[model samples]
Target: MSDAWQHWAGFMADLAAVLLSLTAAALIPILSVRALRYLTARRNDHQRETLHRIASEAAALAEAAFADGNGPRKLSLAIGYAQEQCAGTGITASADTIRAAIEKAVMDYNAMVKPWSGLPAPGAIAKPKGESYSQ
Candidate 1:
């Protein structure tokens, strides 16, 4: 009959409309997640490269300071230089951290060099030369 056919057509139209709306809604979240992931990955790459550069420069400064003698004045200068280089470059470095790294490196170098200087040579016996401090 005509009434039954009309009812069937109305039901199918309603079902199609519901399916289309859901597909559109689901697309928004999928696109947003993809965009967010892309942005986060870019930021991480930049930070990693910057950190590597800061660490290398810090090591150079520490080595130079060690060669100049591990005195307070030299340490202070090294700290200041590192702070200037790494302060606002969007990295996680700080002056105190760099200073600590420099101190550790100096200590390690000193330990490595001590044995060589303290040990006597095969051809000569080691002893104090003279009272250089005598008045």
Candidate 2:
């Protein structure tokens, strides 16, 4: 009877150990995936911020270039600037991607301004050639 009881106790201990090992093995992949997701989210947030900043700067530069009548040159410079900014921010986007993003930003800005363009101010009146300032 004592021999049978000892065998039963040994079997229970081995079973518990095996269950613990299996549990650990199952948790490993779950934990690894969670960590990878966290890291990827952080990287995405950084890239997003970098892209926003680059788009804004490119728009400003493009506007200046357009105003100066050197649209092509300015657009090229904006692209170069974006590439430099991407490198600085650890973004790996290609030049073409950056250029496209900048162009889209500029186009959106132009479209946004087009609505109120060439209109006079609300309270201002245009003066004729012979109009007198004081009446």
Candidate 3:
């Protein structure tokens, strides 16, 4: 009876060990995949924020450095500066994407600083010049 009990106990221990090993094997890959996904999302977010910052700064610099009516020159300066900055920071952005970002930044800046000059304010009426509000 004693020998039989010992054999049963050994079998149970071996079973538990195998189960633990299997659980760890199953969980490792799942955990690894989740970790990888999380890291990728964080990296992408960081890159996007960095690109936007660079675009905004480049746009402002171009606007300040160039005069009005030099649209093409200003765009060229902003794009070149943004591309150079991106390269210096190890970012890989195409010229079109950089241009789009810079344009967006400039639009946003303009909207903030000169709200009436661009698009009309939301829900505002467009009246002819010299027309009174009460008319």
Candidate 4:
């Protein structure tokens, strides 16, 4: 009876080991895939943040450099500047994406800086002497 009990205990131990091994094997791939997806999502988020920052900078620069009446020129300049900056940083973005980012940035900037009157003309904010909005 003692010997039989010892044999049964050994079998149970071996079975537990096998089960643990199988569980680890099955979980490794799943854990790895989840880790990879999390890392990819983080990278994409960082890239998007970088793109938006670059777009905002480009829009501000264009606004400062170009006159208010030169809407087309400002758009072109901002797009070119954003594309150049993105390329320098190894970011790949479409023209439409950059344009949209710039537009959003401009809207945000205007909303923050421009006074909310009853009705104001678009792009008609006058800056005081030595007072810049970009600062």
lDDT of 2 by residue, 6-71 (tens): 999999999999999999999999999999999999998889777867977977876776786677
lDDT of 3 at 13: 100
lDDT of each: 0.68, 0.83, 0.92, 0.92
lDDT of 3 by residue, 27-128 (tens): 999999999999999988898899999999999999999857599999999999999999999889888889999999999998999887866676696777
TM-score of each: 0.43, 0.65, 0.80, 0.77
Better of 2 and 4 by lDDT: 4
Q: List runs of model 4 lying over 4 Å from the truth.
A: 1-6, 117-135
lDDT of 1 at 122: 63
| Residue 91, model 2: Cα distance from true site in angstroms | 1.0
Q: What is the lDDT of residue 5 in candidate 3?
A: 100
The predicted structure with the larger lDDT, 2 or 3, is 3
Cand. 1 TM to true fold: 0.43
Higher-ranked by lDDT: 1 or 2: 2
**lDDT, candidate 2, at 113:** 80
In candidate 2, stretches whose alpha carbon ends up further than 4 angstroms from where it belongs are: 1-14, 116-135
